[model samples]
Target: MSCEQVTTTYINAYYEDMEKLGVRRATLEPRATEHIADIVRLVDTLLTKGMAYRVDGDVYFQVDRYPAYGRLSKRNLDDLQAGARVDVDERKRHPMDFALWKGSRPGEPSWDSPWGPGRPGWHIECSAMAMRHLGETFDIHGGGMDLIFPHHENEIAQSCGATDKEFARYWVHNGFVQINHEKMSKSLGNFFTIREIFQQSEWPDTVTGEMMRYFLLSTHYRGPLDFSDQSLKEAKSALNGFYDLFERLNESDPSHGAADQLLQEATVRTRTAFVAAMEDDLNTPNALAALQTLRGEANKALEAGLSGEMRRMVRQEFRALGVVLGLLQTDTWRFKGQVPQRASGDAESTAKTLSDEEIAVKLAARLAAKKSKNYTLADQLRAELASHGITIEDRPDGTSRWKR
Candidate 1:
């Protein structure tokens, strides 16, 4: 769900995560580029108040007009100027003012605007676009902490100055992702994209999606997440053990029976612990510790040969608690098969041979049958596919795909 792609698959994944927490979905997921009209209007309003100016076909905001400019980041304006490399623009009243729109350049996207058909700058885009979707004021505005200074401060100044309304009631920022106490960077080679990490299926104890989630939430949202192969391996081991217990519970069959009173109480206690942790400004490490403690309790129950009803209750409880921390949502580890071909030089030829159209068709049929309330047909299809070592995820997007 980035700026470029807004596919139904992304929506389905979002809803899946929401369902795990039993939370209602937001009314809209507006893309910043889609709200050009709102952005243009806001920039125009800023210009009317003398808070913004147009220079070289670009609109720039007047940072000095706002007396509270440095309040958010708690830094002195003079100190900022002393440390910064101020660009001299004759049209700008002050050098600290940032651009609201950038004049069109070769190879970059552009749109029609009062500023001579240019594109909105990054900070202005969020302020205008979020206001369009969430109204002039919203309960929460969140992003990575790196955006706090200059970017968020500029957003607050522009939006509030335009609408004369409180921009956001609450501002939340997540911590950084560091590697070995050093900030991750492209030059240092510590940077790894999600796709790159997903490619490491060959190594035993290599982190999967579930383990990655656990490893990520191992630190509080306000704390730094250190990247290391050893930490990820430990997270993988922890997730594998939990999955094994879950598979066992799903396999064993028994009639409905009352779960242990203590087990039910444990469910409530675990959820309470999770909520308390999250309420304290998303302390995910404490929340994750709560999840792990519940896992231990469930393991004890399984080892004691608890009834199917008890196992089911524990399963449902864990699913609800796991979502807020963004863990235990997918079963990607089961598909730890061979890695896909890399686009070295034979990418075109490999694509022709490796595309799974036929298998995808069969999976689609099975999904269709299940959706039609044919459990018998679905079970038969699953059993048939089990022979081929392929796993299927019946997504809400009306498309079926196999992984293995």
Candidate 2:
């Protein structure tokens, strides 16, 4: 695939998980192919420092040259060989030394350098790209824990070994993903691609992007998320609860007095809980629960008809916390239609007879009011739209949209 295609796939997958568990966005996304210049530069510096060598067309890093090779992962060179594909290479000085640049095999992509023609080795790609984006040393570095060996460990060696500076200050590794009780295996015909899944559900293709994000984030990043029908259903239900509140709040006047106060208090608690959970290494499940609690408090206050600064406070808190969780983002709980979309064409036709446009229009109006700085009117419009299960956004770009 082209570099653009690979980056898009990575981004789509990342966003899908974020939406599901309510992560807003990342600081940056650096792709391997895009940082070829940096990789080549780093490779040259490594060679000049005697930490790397070019034999024929291939370049390899001298593992023994870095004395702290196993510091991060606590593995000896001998243990690495136990599971490594260590077929002898005549040009290689040692079996443990890995490729910095792989000499171009007939059809593969290659970039020219002092070391002949080849692409960067996979491990080096991350090291170079991450350093270029996050700097030689950054506060956090994260990836699946499965990458601890060879991949991340190698990154620490190559990046730090070349720059002679510290790499990531904190190393974060998310747990694994499995299907059912067994591991997800393609040979078992149980693998579900995002495309394949969206085709099966009534969920809009656009929303699938968010759904995948939320699903992944629903569980703590450091824990193994069990993928199954039950898990997805639970996620969907949680999503429904969140959107339901947003819809209701949109319909209720933004200046609904007491309700607004409740929203503000709930927002603080939600934010505090969420930050605490994430600070402890992105504990999403607890974060999710925190949102749910905030939701409950808001609902109680709204039902009791809260007013004044209290009502403003409640609304602000709900929106603030919801934004962090990536919930209450879109204007409507549109995924409800997604489930039924799986039905026959005739059923879809019948369902379509019930118009969503009316609600969408009202949500759009609420968004406009919010943008125009008419807080009370915006709240009133949101409340009106909520009765129809619509949600609204007065976005940073000064535009509004609705979904249901």
Top TM-score prediction, candidate number: 2
lDDT, candidates in the order shown = 0.72, 0.72
TM-score against native, each model: 0.70, 0.72
Q: 1-404 in candidate 1: lDDT tens per residue?
A: 55346666776766765443334676776766788898899899999998888788899888887777877778767988788775677677777888888889876778989778788887888887788777899999888998889788889989888888889899888888898988889999888755455554332223355666778778777678887777887877777666666765565545333435666677789899989998988888888778788888777665555677788777777677776655665443444333444332333333422335556566767887888989899878876665444556554455554544
Number of clashes recorded per candidate: 0, 51
Badly placed stretches (over 4 Å) of model 1 are: 1-33, 104-110, 203-207, 247-259, 302-305, 329-404
lDDT of 2 by residue, 251-331 (tens): 534344545555666677778988898777677778878878987887776676655456445556656665665555566
Which residue runs does candidate 2 get wrong by more than 4 Å?
1-37, 83-86, 106-108, 205-211, 247-267, 308-312, 334-341, 344-404
In candidate 1, position 108 carries an lDDT of 73
